[model samples]
Target chain A: MRLQFILSEIGIGLRRNLSMTISVILVTFVSLTFVGAAILTQGQIQKFKGEWYDKVEITVYLCPRDSTVPSCADGEATQEHINQIEQVLESPEVSPEIREVMFESKDDAWVAFERNFSDRWWFTEMSVDDMNASFRIKLTDPEEYQVINEVLTGRAGVEEVRDQREIYEPLFDVLTKATLVASGLAGVMLLAAVLLITTTIRLSALSRRRETGIMRLVGASTLFIQLPFMLEGAIAATVGALLACVALWGGVHYLVEGWLGQNMDWIPYVTTGDVLMVAPWLIIVAILLAAISSIVTLSRYTKV
Target chain B: MIRFDNVTKVYARGARPALNDLTVEIERGEFVFLVGASGSGKSTFLRLTLREEKATSGRVLVAGQDLTALSNWKVPAMRRKIGAVFQDFRLLPNKTVFENVAFALQVIGKPKHHILTTVPETLDMVGLAGKEKRRPHELSGGEQQRVAIARAFVNRPDILLCDEPTGNLDPTTSLGIMRLLDRINRTGTTVVMATHDDEIVDQMRKRVIELQTGELVRDQSRGVYGSSR
Candidate 1:
């Protein structure tokens, strides 16, 4: 048969079963929406991790009253203590790993505290001498955070060492779990959609049993007789997938990235570009799912 | 040619057989009429040749292939050599007359060149060439049956199996369809038609096979419709 003839028959079948076609489209749309959402979330998580890791800092707070070692023996961290910390950071052995080192004195810490909580009544009794001075070191390779933490934790004037990886890991954990859950739900719904598509095709075939029987008796091949129904299902699925892409784009733009970017710029990674970057993938997934389900259903149910 | 050698078809768990241990032969270029009232196995006899139903125990052959032993994949190939015109006319309601006739050739993998030439020629033979663009609903009863016959003969099969081809038409339209089938048979295509119409059977004076309750009661050449009694 000619390609035009086959396509025309498919067109007619879709038109005749309009309601069933719409149902298939709607089911595909909802299923692919979840799939797109999961993908976008995964992309967002990766983007956030990359951006945050680049700026991650390991802060070492020096002991306040020890004054036993070199600069610290002169009471509090003297200029010599600051110089010793700076020497270790500028040493040739570790110089390549340390990009820049920042120093904070007790007075600077006190000033930052007052700046942050000047209006709060609880900070009125706080003083500059009560705070501990610290050093914030930025590394050339964020993955070498463990090496820096080990090197500085037991130093002469060091009080405590902390890496931001400890905090980011928990946030990533929650985001990853959410992505998996959404993907799992989408998978289940996709399976149900395939079954529903199969049933819809079977019913459509049954409704036109007489026509199919005539075609069979006239020596129409199994493929020729089945192509129309399969195409109908595929078209329905494609429509659904397109709708899902649109919904995903709108949801991410106005909802997640929109709200978070406006209020939480300090968090460093919320952006609309992340969701837009995943839009093409969503449409491709929708088309593939619809086509696969239609092919599978036709092969199994319309063989006779 | 079609032949049956001790053909017996029995439905599972049923008391009476659809066709008993019967043997018959239908020659090529012959117009044969199978006659009986309803439920007399006339339909079964037609269906057996089409491979719609197979004999339970004997060799049933059509166009030199044993239908009982033919694989399911080969059934469509066998059907290509045999045209079956159903009582209901089975025209795809959504298609035009041109498309309905073209369907027969398309099913057999005929090229578009052949279809464009052959479909109009066959439709012309059936006297419905001008009604090609009309749908089944747009045509009258006689025109629909003619379209069905045009589709049957479009592929130029060796044999045509028509089950009550004119069962729903008036006398005048029935005669028109019979004349068309007669003209087709004259071109050396064998025809096996099952019918309850007594006048056409007697007028044609063709070979007749009469069935009564799943048994062959009579088989005669140049036979009358009710003469078997």
Candidate 2:
């Protein structure tokens, strides 16, 4: 009987404040959607970081026969100069940091150059002697690039020792910044949701003050008097949270899988699985929003 | 049974007490009238008995429990033993007559089967059986008060406190309500009604406890509305 009465009371309250209830649901839906987006963005950043970091390599470009660099002033890199660089790269002190090393002779370098730029007019102006032979080293740990750079730079017949991270670090930095922006937006929207839920509950309590007074006079406990109002807030917020989950699922299905995934299959993207991981937290946040607002408003307005 | 021992209720410091230092004992099964002019502390007396307001100094006891010392959480249990009616009827405007009377049982956590049997029975006793489906707005003043009275008496409380239950009703309607209260009193539920209806008080000839400026001016058996002056 108590449940029946409380249910009917909840129905009455929701119907009485239909417009405000809708606003509360809409606000909570928007906020929780942002929260899901932030979580998935972070997941995407992690996937890209893991895949690219393992594939990046450092390249040491040796001077050509016509080179003017001081390290190559002795003339074109001879077989002796190339053999000495190879010895240092395979030494026990440096070999562990170097996962794999592939050497390209002047002839090998010329062949790759011709293959890549054959269609350009400048390709006809280039010859095998103008190309620089190089050592390409993939590291076990990309962060230890300084270890290989110190050993190889300014060595005889070497023109420059460069790490490829310089090319990709900026891309990673932009992704990290995007994640931060999404999280910041989620915080602001969550605060708005909290305020809206609190106002809706306070108004509901005020409009039903006469009923509460009568309930109090009939020996109802404080919890009994406040239950219907609390349930009203919970129902609206939970619906918003559930709607957010459905929207996120649809977003990942259509936007990520259908649009982005089809166009760029190699870039590691966040999937619906990532959204599923985030769904529970959005619901928990919605519940906490309702619980806190109910506590704050009912304590003062419906106190027995 | 209700007992007020030197109960002094001061709503604000240095203000005239709503109920001055006064003592009164009401026996079980007795029907009493709490008669006074405006501001004579009749409402405060009922409020203290209900623990709505604690006595500033003295003790107000009901059903052998000292209400002044009752803990806040236990006040609800204390109140269940005493049903309360009001001048305004205090019915939920949106509920039907049956639901309004059933509400009292529901708030106290009664089961569905129990409410179904008791609510209609109580409504029938108060002469509102056939009008169960009507809302408060559809009922006359006396019928609304009957619904309120039925809600109070549904639980078979040991005592019933009515604060001008008939204040807004016509003379004939007020008489009918009084008959119902009399019947409930015959079942051994003590009745304390605060009213200014001189005709009802004079015709009933029950015990009267009159107040003047928050002090007891007269306590007479088989009393009239103006026995002294």
Candidate 3:
């Protein structure tokens, strides 16, 4: 009976302030969506960094025929120059840091160049002599790339030493900054949401002051008078949170997994699963928002 | 039972105390009217009796419990054993008469079965049985006051504190309300009412306590309401 009475009171309170309730729902939804989006974006960047970083390799571009590069000024690398570089890469001291070193000959480089630049007529006109024979060194640990770079670059046959991770760092930085901005906005919006919830509850309580006063006169406890108002806020915020979850699920399922994944298949994107992972936190935040607002405002309005 | 021992309630610092150096007692089943002009501390007497305002320098006891010493949380349980009514008939405008009475029981954690049986019985006792489905705004002023009284009395409290329960009613309605109070008093429930109704007090001929400037000027057992007038 107590539960039923409180539930009915909650319903009445919500209905009495319908517009305020909707605004509360919208505010909560937008704030929690940002929070969910920020978390998922961070998770996505980590997944990309973990998966792509493992496959990142250091490319030791070797001297090519007719090359004018200073590192290759010794002229087209002979078999001895190639053997010297290969031996240095395969030596026991360097081998411990290197996972697997695969050699790319002039012919193999030419094949890749033709496939990539076949649409450009001026590029396909040249022979395989312009292609550099390179040693692709996969590292045991991506963080130890500088160790291999120090050993390989500036050698007689080496033209350049490049860690593949550097090429992706700028992209990761942009994504990380985007998530940070989103998190900052989420923080501001969450504060606004809390304040809005608090104001809405205070207004609702003030509008029903007569009811509460009578409730007190009839010997109603403080909790009894305040429960209905607290539940009103919780209901609004929980609905907002659920709506946020739905928005996040749609964005991940359609935007990230569908369009972005289809366009850039190699880049791992966040999925609906990621949204689901963050769903509980969003709801918990929503409930906390309501509870905090209630705790701050209810005592003054509903106190016996 | 209600007792006030040297009670002084000062709402603001360095201001006139609402009740000053007061000591009074009403037995378990007595019907007493607290009478005075505005600011004579008549309302303060009722407020202190219900512990709505703590006395600044003395003890106010109700139903054998010292309200001045009662903790905040215990006020609810203590209030449960006492019922209060107001001059304006403070009923929820949206709720029906039956719901208004049932709400009193519901807030006290009474069982559904008990509320179901007792609410209508109490409404019937207050002469609003057939009007249970009517809202407060839909009822007449007298009927609205009946709903408030039914709500106050539904819990079968040890004491009924009516603070001008008929203050908004006409003379005939006020007489009816007084008769209803007399009936409730006969049920062995102590009743303390504060009113400016000189006619009702003189006609009822019950004990009357008159206050002037926060001081008890008269405490007359079965006396008229004219000693301090």
Q: Score every model by TM-score.
A: 0.77, 0.88, 0.91
What is the C-alpha lDDT profile of model 1 across A1-304, one tens digit per residue?
Answer: 5687778777877777888888888888898888887877787788887888877788888777653445344466566667787887787877799887888888898889988998988777877776889998888897788777776666667777788778888888998999999999899988877877877787778777777787778777777788778777777887888888788867867776678767876765534576566667766666676667667766666554
Supply the global lDDT for candidate 1: 0.83
**What Cα-based lDDT does every candidate model obtain?**
0.83, 0.90, 0.89
Order of quality (lDDT)? 2, 3, 1
Docking class for candidate 2: medium
| Candidate with the larger DockQ of 1 and 2 | 2
Over 4 Å off, model 3: A77-128, A144-156
Q: Candidate 1, residue B44: CA error in Å?
A: 3.0
Worst 10 residues of 2 chain B by lDDT: B220-229
Clash pairs of candidate 2?
A: none
Give the CA lDDT, 0 to 100, for residue B103 in model 3: 82
Q: What would the per-residue lDDT of candidate 2 be over residues B42-116, giving only the tens digit for each residue?
A: 999998888888899998889999998888888888888889999999999989999898888899899989999
Q: Which of 1 and 3 is ahead in lDDT?
A: 3
Q: Scoring only chain A, what TM-score does candidate 2 earn?
A: 0.85
Q: Residues A166-272, candidate 3: write the lDDT tens digits.
A: 99989989989989999999999999999999999999999999888877776778888898999999999999999999999999999888899999999888889
